[model samples]
Target: MTFQGSLPADRAQSYEEQRASPRFALLLRAAKLVGAEGEYLCIVRDVSETGVRLRLFHSLAAERRLALESAAGERLGIEKVWENGGEAGFRFDVSIDVQRFIAEAGPYPKRPIRVGVEDVARITVSGETTVARLRDLSRQGAGIDIDRHLAIGQHLRIEADALPEFEATVCWRRHPSYGLVFRQLMSLEELAVRAFRMQPGRLR
Candidate 1:
């Protein structure tokens, strides 16, 4: 389904942690919970040095280890404790500075969260159709690989099996990869679900 509407999420919190130092509650802070299966979209509900509570957008995939990454590209190793409804709790490998986590302190400056994907897509420009390799995607833009030469600011429509047809404009190009910004932005929920579907052999 092509999603042009946003989906509402319900709160599901029943996480219990014995050791309590201090808990920081974030307001709709977006982060990525990555596993071997795929990168999952998550919102950090609250956090402490020992553990965190995340609101997941899609079904959780089991993994021995998982990492939570912020928009500024800070990755911290984590272990999943429990999951229920639309929320999950995780324990950190080591104690993290609660202030740093809430502030998103990292090497890189904070930006939009982009999910990586490996897939072949079709591109249509001026009635000409071509193939492209999808690298990564965000709500606003995407990194794509296309052999054909394309000028910056050129418009086209891109189609993929896992996503709706998106009218995009070429933003930049570097050898095998080209950056594209979508004309119609997709919702975060849609992006999460579509990215989940894009992966192969992902078990719930």
Candidate 2:
């Protein structure tokens, strides 16, 4: 079934009433929305204690239940309200503190958003290259798993079919797994789309 281009007038009125609390406009804040099937990248156009407006790049599942995860990895429960023309509205499962959410006040310091992936990649170092699997990706870095251990601080090149070749340095290692910080950062949109592509059973 297809979604209506707009929400029914009665529902629209209901949403308006739900926004009785103070509203906060986040304006193009990138985030991930997780559903039963998988996750999709979305932008937080604005938010309030009760509801939020999100901008979507693709169609979302029909499930009313979902979660919105921030760039800092904080997750909030949301119920789908309305979806139309690549955008959707949701109401937080419970009223949230607008100030704390906007400020990203959480248990840990805010960090860049990262997505988990498992695509094959090649890591080149010291004139030798070997196959690796992409463990996770962020705008500034990626996690990889390889069989061999390499010294930290070594500059290397990462090649993959789905991503541009990246120049990075080994930042951390744990036997077969390694963390690499990229020399160049990806734009939020690029990171979002690329992340979607790397996920299993990604939305068509």
TM per prediction:
0.87, 0.85
| C-alpha lDDT (0 to 100) for residue 44 of candidate 2 | 88
Task: Give stretches of model 1 more than 4 Å off.
Answer: 1-19, 200-204
Off by over 4 Å in 2: 1-16, 61-64
Quote model 2's TM-score: 0.85
* Quality of model 2 by C-alpha lDDT: 0.82
Per-model C-alpha RMSD: 7.7, 3.1
Where does the lowest 10-residue lDDT sum fall in candidate 1?
Answer: 10-19
lDDT of 2 at 39: 66
